[model samples]
Target: DTAVSQTPKYLVTQMGNDKSIKCEQNLGHDTMYWYKQDSKKFLKIMFSYNNKELIINETVPNRFSPKSPDKAHLNLHINSLELGDSAVYFCASSQAVQSTDTQYFGPGTRLTVL
Candidate 1:
């Protein structure tokens, strides 16, 4: 019984491959977000959706896309995966930022390239 889970907790592949990571939240929250934390420990917001509507979109690469089917799920799709794309992908959710709500994050999906 996990609050949120990302498929393929670890993904290893080469360059130019396409992969997707699925996320689901059972917390009944209204917002879902995708975040990337680099080796420098800089956590950047990639994308966010509220109730299946895109609310925040950061300056991310075109190869990365986020899809929210409902309030409880947001999936990330990566195209032409590059070596630079290797990072920890985290899925999170919150009621609203205005509410000063903290987001719940998954363990993280580690994508390694070789």
Candidate 2:
């Protein structure tokens, strides 16, 4: 069984479309994160939730929102999806939000916008 899983592994839409991606983890992790990988293969952290509290990266656009209803689930909502937002989104979980903890990543949801 997958420790971390994300829904709608692929998304294709036009610009300005709104979308939501859901993620769930069965590892009982206290922290979950969302990452974006651009076409150039540059990966960056967008948001993180620890026990339902949000910690967002300064570089992330305000249009992107992450919500955690509980410790086991974190969902992402993007408004006015732009071309630059077309990338692979990864959901990850760690035992804790410590710098030394290793994170387990999901397969990733690839988004393509026309």
Give Cα-based local distance difference scores for all models: 0.90, 0.91
Best by TM-score: 2
Q: Candidate 1's C-alpha lDDT? A: 0.90
Q: What is the C-alpha lDDT profile of model 2 across 1-114, one tens digit per residue?
A: 999999999999999999999999999999999999877788789998889988656488889988899999999999999998889999999999898999999999998988
Assess candidate 1 and give its TM-score to the true structure: 0.94
Worst 10 residues of 2 by lDDT: 53-62
Q: How would you encode candidate 1's per-residue C-alpha lDDT over 1-114 as one tens digit per residue?
A: 999888889999989998999999998889889999999999999999988999889999989988887788899999999989999999998877544888889889999976
State the number of backbone clashes in model 2: 0
Q: What stretches of model 2 exceed 4 Å from their correct place?
A: none
